[model samples]
Target: MDNQYYCNRCDREFQNFNAIKSHYSDSHKKTLHYACSTCYQCFETEAALATHRRNNPGAAPHQREPKAT
Candidate 1:
């Protein structure tokens, strides 16, 4: 039977569906055109990097906010 999984982009063979999915996502999902300057993490687009920065913000080094009363 045709139970095997393969990468749609590269045609690489895989037996498990999740493995192939991850492989595709990591290897082929994005073009990797953008990267974060602070963390040097890669992203597929500028919007993604902007979103990451907005979410993380890198507020402060070794600093914390006061606990709510």
Candidate 2:
């Protein structure tokens, strides 16, 4: 069986865990900018933002992709 590693911080796909960890540590060791407009809350992934929006009736979270710097 093969495992696939997906990085939400950098929006990257990796085949190995070690490589993804190194890439994440080097490239995305910063704040994620996927903020919620209603409460100005930040989240690490879009799925988290979506879950937040779903939980909050009036959230209306922004659908922006955060670029790693």
Candidate 3:
């Protein structure tokens, strides 16, 4: 297929790069990100939560940080 993104870990095909990246990061890597304390918002990736914090400067960090594997 043209312009397809396939996961190296699971060999799954995706139409876009973000889908493949998210799939690998979430399913394979299992890199969990803590959600915001105040609003309690969780995201699939750290960058997503970082963007949220950047947009909302008042957002407080989660009490429990993600453990390193």
| Full ranking by TM-score | 2, 1, 3
List, residue by residue over 1-69, the lDDT tens digit for candidate 1: 244654435767665444554565688863444434444444445676578678887733221112212
Clashes of 3: 0
Candidate 3 RMSD to the correct structure: 10.8
Highest TM-score scorer: 2
Q: Model 2: what TM-score?
A: 0.45
Cα error, residue 43 of model 3, in Å, equals 0.4
Runs off by more than 4 Å, candidate 1 = 1-26, 59-69
List the candidates' TM-scores in order. Answer: 0.43, 0.45, 0.41
Question: Deviation in angstroms for 17 in model 3?
Answer: 28
**Pairs of colliding residues, candidate 3:** none
Give the range where candidate 1 is weakest over 10 consecutive residues by summed lDDT.
Answer: 60-69
Alpha-carbon RMSD of each model = 15.3, 10.5, 10.8
lDDT of 3 by residue, 1-69 (tens): 565644544667776545555676778874434444445444556676677688898766546445334
lDDT of each: 0.50, 0.59, 0.57
Using alpha carbons, what is the TM-score of model 3?
A: 0.41
lDDT of 3: 0.57
